[model samples]
Target: MSKTHEVVIVGAGFSGMAAAIKLKEAGIDDFVILERKDEVGGVWRDNTYPGVAVDVPSFTYSYAFEPNPSWSRTFAPGNELLDYAKHCSDKYDLRRHLRFHSDVRTARFDESEHLWVLELASGDRVSGRYLISAHGPLVTPQKPSIPGLDDFQGHVIYTMEWDHEHSLDGKRVAVIGTGASGLQVIPAIAPEVGTLTVFQRTPIWVLPKVNPPINRFASGLLAHVPGAAAAARLSTSAATEALLLSFIYNKQVPFAVKSIEQLCRAHLRSQVPDPEVRRKLTPTYGFGCKRPSFSNSYFPTFLRDNVELVTDGIERITPTGIRTVDGVEREIDTLVLATGFKVLDVPYDLHGVDGETLLELWARDRKQSYQGVTVHGFPNLFLSPGAFGLAGPSLFATFDLCHGHALRVIKESRRRGATRVEVSQVAQEHWMEKMRARVGHTIFNNPSCAGSNSYYVDEHGDSAVLRPTSTVNAWLAQHRFPFNAYRFEEPSAPAVSARRRATRAAR
Candidate 1:
């Protein structure tokens, strides 16, 4: 039998690290962090494709408490982000709590023991009083269901698991999917590849990027100056929040949406000289239907003589190349799948009260939670980014808000000496209804977004990912949400006390 811990956190990325730090700060030290990979950085550690850099500014991307003063660029590269993760791990002593290469297969709640039991891929079991799922939605890569893809003879690479061993220099390459990953990798490999063909299912709104180097003097000021880092973070956060709000409240702020559309159109017109090429690159959907990307080079790469953009629908993959519905087969030496991740899908199995699985509950009803942190049936389980949980574009801010709410519950449980804590079904239902109404006003629900193919919309055709509320309101909700909404229960059985004694004795 595995010894039970106070808390068990999955994924050692920024979210897990933040949870661990908060737990320690709250004086709860008996916690374990389970990481599937050997390293700490989650997406930054995995995605090493060429031209992989953050779309958001570096200042806002980092943790508020621990800001890096030496970011070389406005938008830092993936490697630098990984280095920051390592630095944070060492600085916070998180390595001691981390269990590397521990892949969680399933998590089931043990009602009798009032504990969450995690079964790992290695057939190991871990028990914890509280479970925090820090693994993000983008962890699982989504492969395009193109027929005859396995029949391809050439090397196939996923953007998530990039193969640096095989050189792409002077090789004919074909990239599928025009999402964020596709946008970044296309420009990076275009200059090196012999001939590049980009297959686009849907066009993305591309805005001009303003990435400037932060020199030594500026870096020093940000580091040594008392208010410099705070000021920078504040300004960047404010700017991004304003932009995100305009999208969330498109019905209320029509002018902001129109302004953004005009700016994107002007940028596309300025970059691509050919009118026909520009038409193919432009998105018919309204701005913010899908997440917009920033790149000065993506549009210009199409102008290159070696690059070709194919807007035709993909029919199937042949032995040597991809065949479009237009009946053209573009032979290529390598196939790069820049297809995005399964954002709306849960990757692992999770069982809650009375053998009710999370998948079953979501399928029966819909993916929802009280605060995007806690669900009704899943007691003592907290999700960092739950359904309708993400508060803003900046993931760091969302982590702060979500984890802050989780910590409050954990602290309250400790104070009340409660062994089990779960949100009331009534409370969850009320929250879900409010969220549904709020999401209706966002641009995602607009008629223009019907063909956007955005991950924000779930299987039920609801925009269930984003919180659809302002960041300020999210923070207020975290602090001011009534604790009475949860039902806290103390240990009622002798077996539970005996189990705790056994766990302590084993430790």
Candidate 2:
């Protein structure tokens, strides 16, 4: 028999670390955090591209409990953020509880035993009373399906899995996809590359990324002054949450949209003076239709004589170059794929009760969950960025809120001595009915999203990513909502009997 733990957490990233720290705080330490990678930091650890940094501001990106006073800038770089992750792990002594390189092949709930049994890649089995899927949406990297990609002769690399050894100095480079990664990478490598060709599938809204360093005085004030950092975090959170009004509340973004467009236009006009090029770079979609990127240097990078921005669609990939639909074949020394990740859909397999997989359930009913955390058929299972709950202007805000709710449920179950806790189908239905009704009113459901090629909207053309609620409201709902919405399995007969005898003997 495999050793059973109180909880088994998959993915030792931020979410997993948060869960572990919260569990410890709750006096529950019999949990194991399994990470496939050799270290923590999830996407931060994986993505080490030329100009990797967070899109969100630094103050609000961090956890409220562990504020980093030494954030170098308002938006810290990827390495700095990764260091913060390591610091959190070290601070909390989470290393002792972590199992590195322990990749989970599959997880199944043992109905009769009331436990979650996970199979590792090394053919090892681990059982636990509860299971938490902390592997976030952007864990898996995706490459575009282009013909002759495998036959490409030169070096091919992904932004997530960056090839650090391969130098781009004076080398002709062809970059595919102009998403967030593309926007960041293009500017960083343009000055070094001999010739750079940027393939734009769709133009994304680019805002001014004026990242000013947090001065030493301010850093010291935030660190030394009581409640200063907290105040800054609150201010940033409020601002981020304010963007949600533009995202879901208003059918049109109103003044926010116009103001943002003006800023983008100014940025583009100032950087790329050529009218034709500016027109080619401008996005036709609404402000919040697709993920808006920010960068002061991105638009200006194209102004370089060696850089070429190609708007034509990819016809096919040749042995040495990419042939566009316009019959233009751009020869390349190396190919870099900035092609984003699989967000709306997770490729990993999960088996629940009666050998039913999550994919099968989603296939039958469409992918959804109660409060974007719990699934009906999956007992003792909690998911991050599940279904409709994935969205938040600040993902960390969402994570903090969700972690509190999940831990609350776990604590409630433990208090009741329950063997397992499962969300009822009726409860899930109630939440989804309300969520979908609210979805119709949001901008995500708009036709503009599909036109923008946003992954936020799923294959069904419905907004699958966002939770359609305010961040504060989400936090409140998690705290105020009734845990009775879930069904808790009763303790074993033997345990109950033993407890009764002990009580009688004490009397």
Candidate 3:
């Protein structure tokens, strides 16, 4: 018999840690967090490039339950954020429940046993009553499918898996994809590199980053003064929400969208000071069509004589450099793929009841889910911020909502003396209808967003990366959702007695 846990959580990132902390707070400690990596802090730990800092303000990006008073800047750097994750883990004693270096290979439902049978990379077997997938969307790095990529003789690295050992000092560097990571990295390395070339598949709209330092006085006030950090969090959250307004709802209103566009254009004009370069940098897409990046130095970096921006499509990569569609070749010493991750792709296989594969089901069903947490055919399994566009301006807010919804379902199942819980097919269909109706009205489906090449859209030309609703609306829906939309089942008589004892002990 395999060892069984009441709950088995995959990925010890913020979502997994938050779920574990909530479970312990609810007096249920019979759970385990399995992390593939040797450490926590998911994205922050992985992406340690030159200018790696969160675009979101430090205050609202952090958990409301555990506020950090020592953030050095409004937009905290990668290392400081990793330290915050470790601090939370230590403070909450989550280290005891973590299983490090335990990469789960497979998780299949054992129908007769009423448990999920998991196989680890080390060939260890484990079973759990409930399975939670907190492995976020940014785990898998997506390398561009370019010809002769391997033929390159220079040191190549992905921004996600940055090569810290190799230094770029006075080296001729080429960076592909001018998205979020590219924006930050270009400015950070332009001064150090002998020459920097940025390849642009699509231009991005960049807003001025309000990244002021948090001095000692502010840190002291946040630590000692009650509600000081809370106030800051609220203000920052409001700012992000305001920006999200035009993106999701008010795209039709030119005035609403133009206000933000003007800000971005002014920011660009202020930095570049060259009309031709600024015109090339300006994005033709609508303001809310793609994910926007914020930076104070990205625009300025392009103005430097040592940097070159290439707008042509990459035909192929050579041993020495990249060849553009225009028959131009730019030589380089190092290649850095700042291409984004596979957000809509599932990293691993998951099998549910009757040996149903989740990947196939998602493909057949257009990768839809109920509020980005539950699926119809998958019983006893909860997805944290489901594959479909459940992300928001505030990731913390989005994950918290999904966690709350999933936790409520788990708690309600126990309350009803049930061992299995599944979202009804009717309810799932109803939610899908609502989701499509809401998404159809948003800017994601607009004609302007069609050719933007955003990862947010699926192959079927539908938005798959963001819930077409506001963060506040998502929170309310999760809290007030009907629990009866799911079917709950009681265990066998013997198992019922065991569960009763466990529940009593937990109390």
lDDT of 3 by residue, 25-112 (tens): 8888999998889998988888899999988898988899999999999999989999999999999999999999988888887655
Could you give me the TM-score of model 2 versus the true structure? 0.95
Question: lDDT tens string, model 2, 1-507?
Answer: 366899998888788898898899989999999899999999899999999999888888888899999999888999999999999999999999999988988888877678898888888898998988888888778878899999999999999999999999999999998989998999999999999999998898988876899989999999999999999888877767777667777565567766767888888888888898899899987777888878988888888999999998899999999999989898998999998887845445789786878878777777789888889889999887688875555777667766777898998998898888999989999998998888876877666565688887766666777888777667778788788899998867776687589779979
Residue pairs with colliding backbones in model 3 are 389-464, 389-465, 389-466, 389-467
Looking at model 2, the pairs that clash are: none
Candidate 2 achieves a global lDDT of 0.85
lDDT per model, in order? 0.91, 0.85, 0.85
Error of 3 at 316 (Å): 0.4
Query: In candidate 1, which residue pairs clash?
Result: none
Candidate 1 residues lying further than 4 Å off, grouped into runs, are 500-507
Candidate 3: where is the Cα deviation over 4 Å? 251-254, 388-392, 492-507
Give me the runs in candidate 2 sitting further than 4 Å from their true place: 491-507
- Listing every candidate in turn, what is its Cα RMSD in Å to the true structure after a full C-alpha superposition? 1.4, 3.4, 3.0
Worst 10 residues of 2 by lDDT: 249-258
User: Over the stretch 1-507, how does candidate 1's per-residue lDDT look in tens digits?
Assistant: 466899999999999999999999988999999999999999999999999998888899999999999999988999999999999999999999999999999999988778999999999999999999999778999888999999999999999999999899999999998989999999999999999999998999987888889999999999999999999989888988988998799888878988989999999999998999999999999888898888999999999999999999999999999999989999999999999998745567889886878878888888989888899989999998888888865999989998999999999999999989999999999999999998888999789897898988878887888999999889999999999999999988786779689779979
